[model samples]
Target chain A: MTNLQETKPLMHLLSATFDSLQSATPEQLEHNPFLQLRKQGLDALARTGLPTPRDEEWKYLNLAPYIRHPYQLPAGKESLSHLPQILPITTIPVVFFNGLFQPHLLSPVHGVTVTSLAQLLDRGSHDGTALGEQEHSIGQLLSPEDDPFVALNAALLHQGALLHITQNPSQPIYLASITQSDQPLFVNLRFAIRLSTGTAATIILDLRTLSKTAPTFHNIVSEIWLETESALTLIFLQNDTAQNYGVLTTRIAQTARSRSRLYTITAGNGMVRNTTSVQLNEPEAETVLYGLSVLRDTEVADHHTAVEHLAPNCQSSELYKSIVADQATNIFNGKIFVHPEAQQTNAYQSNHNILLSDDAQVYTKPQLEIFADDVRCTHGATVGQLPQEAVFYLRTRGLPETVADVLLLHAFAAEVYEQLPLEPLRAWIDQQLSHRLFDIVDLAADRKLVDLQFATS
Target chain B: MHNAKQPLLTIENLHVAVDDKQILKGVDLTIYPGEIHAIMGPNGSGKSTLAAVLAGREDYTILQGRVFFDGKDLLEMSPEERAAAGLFLAFQYPVEIPGVSMLTFLRTALNEIRKSNGEEPIDTRTFLQRVREAAQLLELGNDFLQRAVNVGFSGGEKKRNEILQMAVLRPKLAILDETDSGLDIDALKIVANAVNSLFGTIQSYLIITHYQRLLNYIEPDYVHVMYDGKIVRSGDKTLALELEAKGYDWLRSETLSSIELPSTTT
Candidate 1:
């Protein structure tokens, strides 16, 4: 882009934000104490200012668009009692509208506290973890000093969830967000999930927009803390409308004996960037990461992930797959780090992409940082089309070129979708895959594929 | 009690070359609907080239030839279209597709053929039944169907799977390209039995091999000897034995000496 576009101020874009949302936040924050603190925190953020491209993480994904646009965090509104009937599969469900929390949409479950970030901080019990002792870590991470959007979200996150699972919670909890923003504006959300010792559960956090006419911006920060003997699986589904712009920052710290797996699938939108980091803090800790992004028609989706093993006997693996068709561009940066003392560490990382059209573009970089002499850490990245032999093998069986292409594409995507163990999650993802393909291939033909002999014999 | 049907496949004046290098020169062959024709030749002979040319392997570009399957313009269609029209090729070396289960692969290929032929896809129950039967036909354990196609499979198991695929496909014209090269006696017997059963049906096969031993169980109606990209002679099933006893060297010398050679199917 030209320098003029880069320097333009967001005041020009402020006219589009959902700015009329101050009155509804108080009651929502009262139900969830975190809302009260968040409002105070966001007020402090407003005094500060936004960050420029000079920030290292925001280098490649310049926040010119975000910086140019002005937005106020939507305050927590009255209880959103009537949640949408069209619900997706989730373990622990949380609702946020226009960047504020909707508590009535939350399910009341045991062994877990379901309150606003305010109440959870004021009255919720903790085991002295970072989130328990330093609830402001998110605030610290998002302040204008570190991140402008973080500060904005801290000030604006009307009612956020303070989800704390005690020792070895047996069931998976889902956090689903359906953003019904009324206009083209900026929205930020913050979440902190802390798991105590011996706790094991799966979590699905989904972010989606209910409206499409307005141009919207969603900047999110989520932190996951895991203690010893804890197992956590996080699935992040960002199904943004094409008129939306989003940036998500996810950070995780896995302590001794803690196992963590993070997966993200992104589709639709003008530009979307996801930055995730998994730090293995102690020995015997393992991490698994698998993410897939499908972009269609003049869209751009980028995913950046870093998995670091700092202690000995730590193991981690990351694999990211991107499928871009038409005029879509994808950027993937995967890095695996092994500290010097982290000998016997096993880390593997790879990023693979498939471009369906000549107009599509992809930039992928997989890196390994190893200071430990005895560690085994490797990384690789590739962007290409389906194998010719694979295509021919299918064609020789009587499938048309289009059918063969779709089948191979599905096989490539199955690597990511199949990693999701939940049946409902898998079914939901499969439905999305069908629609994603419909954007490229004629939907009628794709719909007609059901007549296909699933088994040729 | 069997009524002879007209020949199901005919290859005439088949001249093929791969990358401008001539491989098959003036080769001819014909097979009846129930007949199994075995072509035995020395290394570098046109045995494989003929099979590839017929299956439309890109390597062997057909320079001069015509193949008639069910009296249609077979050469005009693609390899896949041919298969859908009742043609099956048991590859000499089956390709491996990791992350793809044999069950899914077979079902997809089978379904593609069925759909192209305007038939409904098999229901789960019927599909499973057919898989079980095909598995038994080749003595393959049901576990084999779950493994990736030919990946980590024993040498013998790979060949058996080729036959199993044929049994599942049930094509009218099955082409076995060196299907028995790497099989042990037991595997060879299982494969032979599979091929034997496939006979007496509407299906016929063009079996290519370097050895005459496979013909022991799955006897061929006619055996032709190919050498140097040309079929040098045509004879009954006994011709394979004669050639086995007296190597191709003997046939080469006789072809050069005979002044009044009959105008055979070449």
Candidate 2:
């Protein structure tokens, strides 16, 4: 094939993508001034184009499976009344369908307000400041090489939610975003949460795919900006179905003496990708990321996170544990970067995985890039099955094989349970996990390390 | 084939080693019903090796030996299998399994032993009742049942817990390997008391220790002095007192020359 033939097909796809970004019109953005910055952001997204297998980030997790199932946007007003009750955990619900928000599906808190990204853009940029993703970097799919999914998310800029936490105390605000999508579609949402000094609250982003077989593509970007002396606790539970393909890009920027703690418990069946990056932009800042996942069958769960200490006196601890069964696969990439100026920093990360089947695979990489002389950094990764000695001990005690297996599994997950502060929510998640999981009681006898499995209330 | 008529245990020349280091050269011993045999030895005398060899720790290999109990071979069994075969070894260092409650471990071990004995399974009510009785006799608080096995326990508490396990399992042959090492005077007495209360004419015991302090509470019918890889002397409980008074030097003084005399000539 000549160069003309190869370039010809790419030319048509490029033209189509360029036309899509033309959705950036004054009328579409409405009465917004951030449109100027938004246009520049979209132009950058268009320039990056769609990533292919050549891109390392998307190497292990290909977007081709999602791209093959092209989807049409939702038409007319959908029946989201039934969806309100679906988010049974809290009163404040932030609802989205195919990446589009349905203001009708939410019951707003008295002091809280709910609006779409289009409305916010129409209102213009924050105080007319020109902060247009200055570094202009889209992380890679598997590598941080700038994934095409991120560009696709940026292309559909108006379909996200503008979740403003603001500076408040009263009662802790509960922000929930539920996605109820139809058909195989690509839904992109950008969450902007700005917490002022001394502001505190809880936020939850719950992804719900309304169908099972027809695939769904959900590429979301969350920007969490923290102020000095402020604290934010975000719990993300991605419980979408097996056929859904989704990736979440969470970018956190914390201030001096500010602390941000994030707990992500990913369950359910799917090809799920999660990217969480925490930037220690100021001194005396603390960031913690705790995650637990249980993937079975042929499902795949990939987590890529980086905790960057750009300032001195910052600290971070990241622990991620996964239990894979059958042919399920999990990949964990946790990196800790300490800049030369960031002295007296303490950063630690550990990724542990338990494989139930011999064929089940786990790829864990823990990287530490330290340039500072006075910083303390340690990172370790381990992937294997339950300890045979621990297993034999439980089995000898007369626990059935299935019961022993369950107990061993529960023990593997107990490390993350230590970080969850909410009892009810933790209990609910633990209960649901035990229920949906395989019958582990029959694994064998003499497996003694399982009392945690019976900790279910 | 093991009915009520069978002897509790049978042993042949049991040679065991840990990490290829032979600890027991050729140990020959046996115990029938209604007997207590105390094997007293100095440090590095391999008394504990016999206990561990019988417990079926895979870390030690029996190069040449046959251990039969209740008409079945004990050497050809897993650690838990030996326990179910009515053979128990109170470890010198009881393993601490975090998150596993003492009550759960004991009940499971006891029921497995019972099941092997052909008795009906004990229900939860009976299990709780038995645990309460055993815990009280062992001086263990009700809270101990809720805590993880051997975790956060004092030296005395750990010994008492081991005896508490022996009381619960009611094994045919209960081997105590330095079970008195970490116990204080009071804890040692409590553990000994639990041992005395749990023992009966139908069961037997083989207690291994360095000092004569544990002998003050659990009186033994026979005391054997273990030197090098063999039992050099055998007597009644009075042998333990003579050793405490004369010291292990008395046996070492005589045995060292006889073995050393041959080595000098060689």
Q: Which predicted model would earn the best lDDT?
A: 1
> What TM-score does candidate 1 reach?
0.85
Q: Estimate, for each residue in B61-173, the C-alpha lDDT of model 2 and write its tens digit.
A: 78887888878888887776777777777778766666567765676566656655677667778878888888998888898888877779877787788777777777778
Model 2 chain A weakest lDDT span, ten residues long: A136-145
lDDT of 1 by residue, A414-444 (tens): 6776767777667667667756765565445
List, for all models, the DockQ compared with the true complex: 0.34, 0.19
TM-score of 2: 0.76
Compute the lDDT of residue B160 as modeled in candidate 1: 89
Candidate RMSDs in Å, in order, are 5.5, 6.6
Candidate 2 Cα RMSD (Å): 6.6
Give the interface RMSD of candidate 1: 3.7
lDDT (Cα atoms) of all candidates against the true structure = 0.72, 0.69
Evaluate model 1 with DockQ and give the value. 0.34
Against the true structure, whose DockQ is highest?
Answer: 1
